[model samples]
Target: MNIDLRVIGEAFHQFLINIGLTSGQASLIDWIFGALILLVIFIVLAILLIWFERKLAGRVQDRLGPNRVGPFGLIQPIADTLKLFTKEDITPAGADRITFNLAPTLAVFSIVMAFAVIPFADKVIGTDINVGVVYLMAFASVSSMSLLMAGWASNNKYALLGGFRVVAQLMSYEIPMAFAMLLPVLLAGTMRMNGLVEAQGQFFGLGWNIWIMPAAFIIYLTTALAEGERAPFDLLEAESEIVAGYNIEYSGLKFAWFYLAFFMNTWVLSAVATTLFLGGWQGPFVSQVPALGVVYFLGKTIIMFVIFAWIRATFPRLRIDQMMSFCWKVLVPMVLVLFLLTAIILKLGLPTIAVWLLILLSNVAVFVIALWLLGKGLEKSKWASKRLFTPEIPRL
Candidate 1:
């Protein structure tokens, strides 16, 4: 049962080389095949995520969701996909046709490109580049440009406003998210995703970065929620306020791509979060059984996504000002402080255990201070002292 897919892949690769194909040609083919497989995986996961989120939302609100479509509502997403496929594709008459069309494509493309650097399992990555983290950050930012394009080219004021919000929201959140990503990169002393995972292989697969730098993990998750446009941070598509936001002009298959990309981005960010904080693909017996690494990786990613869905279901959306204020007034400063503390601690040339202890203590202290400050700010707000009910009043 110890089926290492890498061995099979390598054998197939060798067979290609033996059959009159040049090494370069074999590699090209391998890459293309891998890309196709990854794309297919994205599609499948998008469907599953849609179904899962709907079901989770239903459960949170005490309702049965999509049960009639298929067993446990599994086929609902597929049905929805078909519906989108058959819907009429529309383009606004006065819109910038080229940019409008390209926006959704770029949105999906940027996310897929970012996935190129994610290490899914042991020896199972799209490409093992030296600056994998940098590569990921670069591609992820491209989605912002896509949103801008979609919003500006639509010739719709609402879409334009939605696009502008993307710049304000994603750009602000990304600063803290980038700094938060640095904790693991610095700890491992390498920007490579695989290196980060291997660095956490100590302590019987229990030496997760989250244990040492929980504050960074929290910061990253918060910013990531905003970056991925999830609930509470989903001001980008505030349908109530902006009439569906940047993709408001999109419809039919064009709209479906944006929809697919949204779910896929959620999964990708969850995977990256797991890889950074959880001992990604580094569970018990994973070194002996490499295939199990994929299992571990996916399981951790799914758990992270569940946390995301749960938060989306529970928390109400934040006002735009509150969201931006939290990022700038709160998360940015906190993450910057956390980054500096960890950096200074690691530079002290202490023993490994001492470094971990110091970093953990610093993270805890920062967390408590941030909570106290947030509480104080909340208490000062007008809503704090206002109450609809009084202890002395009887029910009407």
Candidate 2:
């Protein structure tokens, strides 16, 4: 019958019906089945990502990493998981035991909730909410609060400072991130994640939003990194700075939860990018064989993950002040301008290609202008260097 929207889910419902279940019961059962499947897939990916990151880091740094565990160190994640499980759970003597323990769990849980809206294939989303895009952003904001919990609960000055840093960072970046996402919403006229993908449909299976809104794509990627706590945005984990930041006092499995959440956030960020810009499950042959959609989605996600790892390997961390300044002084203004530009273009009722060209031009101009300003600022900073000139004596 109607397998066009969500074939896998529809097939599962049929299977349940064959077993003599009523429609309502089968629908409920199918949802549970999908949820469980999504959970298992998330865990498997988290394990693989941990291993991949370590191996990538080792190669980048010219050292062997996790060579002794499994084939090509493939079982390294399993070993690490066991290690964390076996370690002592140390709660600081001065810590608030309840919040200390609960924060990590909440950290992990908040991100896991995002797995529900991601569509692995058409109709295969975990109960596609009407406002899937908004849901993801809201949940992402909620996860940051968990960092505050961890930092304050530890009762250490460093932990408290790290919490403040996270709040400040999240606050600074969230605006640009949300505004950046609205570009796609502006074009698609819907906040549904699936709708965003479908709206990108064009001649020759190339309706991805990235081509239409390249500036938004770049901004989204940058803000996504900040949101996910990836380097060079990983101020939360600055060991020499804040003493390992919010999770400083965490150890053992509780710490493991925070650790997993960090990487899991990375995965979610990449997946969301894939969905919004790269056309989540939209690809050749996807219409004929729906399972292929999952392949395309995963492939794009892996590529995004590699870029994340490359940044981690290549760039040094930014100072907290620098990070905050970049977000506010730079990204915020750029995205705000982008928002008005998007509204004006849509209001003008231009041809799709014309709209695409105008936006692309604006994005290029913004990029060039941003670089020029940054470079000029760098030159000014060079002139202001205390080493380059005598330090002005303070008039006491």
The candidate maximizing TM-score is 1
Per residue, candidate 1 scores C-alpha lDDT tens digits across 83-135 of: 99899999999999999999999999998887777888987888778898878
Best by lDDT: 1
Worst lDDT run of 10 residues, candidate 2, spans: 378-387
Q: Can you tell me which runs of candidate 2 are displaced by over 4 Å?
A: 1-5, 14-23, 381-396
Pairs that clash in candidate 1: none
How close is every model to the real structure, measured as TM-score?
0.95, 0.92
lDDT of 2 by residue, 60-152 (tens): 999988889779899989988889989998999999999998899899888889999998877767867789988998888778889999999
RMSD per model, one decimal: 2.3, 4.6
